[model samples]
Target: MRLLIFLIIVVPAAEISVLLLSGKTIGFIPTISFIILTGVIGAWLAKRQGLQAIKRVQEQISYGEPPGDALLDGLCVLAGGIFLLAPGFITDFTGFFLLIPAGRNIVKPLLLKIIRKMIDRNQITIYR
Candidate 1:
């Protein structure tokens, strides 16, 4: 909750400051165009990655194997898509990484390790 509040307040202010500086240096039209281009490219990459992840998950299900990492990849792709839709370079760069298969694989293990530790410590609970 606190993180969310900090992100909501800080991210926009930071983005606006960066945008202003970029606009001044590169001109407003070019800055806006760059943002739009990043968004379009990010969306395209996200869609491609999302479909691949889904297909992999389906294959795992059919093989009676767990799709643990695939699920995480799908989540990263979704987050990337959302971030891309938001107007900011920092978010877009992070989003681009999330949309990449290699990046997803790298992040998945770290996330799983953290999750496992939390579960072991009983720090997280599922209602269902």
Candidate 2:
């Protein structure tokens, strides 16, 4: 709830500030071009990573192993791609970060922790 509120308020403000500064520094056309370029690049990277993760999941399944890590990777890539689709510098940066392997590894544990907390609080339930 707090995170949702913070993002709703802060992300737009930060994006606007960054966009205004970029426009002033590099001119309007260049700023817009840069944003578009980042979006395209982020999308490409996310697709590549998502495919790789899916492949890993398939491999794990073939080996009769759980694909938990690969599944998380796919989720992260999906989120990164979604973020990239949004037209904002802050989101673009976040999208690129999430699309990267090292960044995904860094965030995976945090994401798992949050999920565990949600399960503990009955906000989420898992059935097997």
Candidate 3:
């Protein structure tokens, strides 16, 4: 799709621009150090959040309830962890936003809507 192509090209270009600007503004060593620090912290946060999501899923299963929401949370955390591990300031920020509960809440409905749309369009298939 055009949007995917735009993102694939634009996002990396933007990320590189920001990274170069950061290095020039803050000095290369400090910029790299900050990036490393954020990656470490983000990984830790993602792990903790992922564990909590797993617990929630288990609890829901024990109650004979569907684990959809918990599963979505796990997905967000997984994506966040991956983004954090990537070398870019924009991705690190997005990774943190996805990993944090408050921010995740802001995104969940949007994600759910997208999933529903995909399912409706037969773009995604779920097997029971």
The C-alpha TM-scores of every prediction are: 0.90, 0.93, 0.93
Q: Model 2, residue 101: displacement in angstroms?
A: 0.3
Best by lDDT: 3
Worst 10 residues of 1 by lDDT: 119-128
Summarize candidate 1's per-residue lDDT along 10-36 as a digit string, tens digits: 888988998999999999999999999
Query: What's the distance in Å from true for residue 123, model 1?
Result: 5.1
- Minimum summed lDDT over a 10-residue window in model 3 is located at 6-15
What C-alpha lDDT, on a 0 to 100 scale, does residue 3 get in candidate 1? 94
Looking at model 2, residue 123 earns an lDDT score of 100
| RMSD in Å for model 2 | 1.2
lDDT of the structure predicted as candidate 1: 0.90
> Any residue pairs clashing in model 3, and if so which?
none
Q: Report the poorest 10 consecutive residues by lDDT, candidate 2.
A: 39-48
lDDT of 3 by residue, 57-107 (tens): 999999999999999999999989988988889999999999999989998
Q: What is the total number of backbone clashes in candidate 2? A: 0
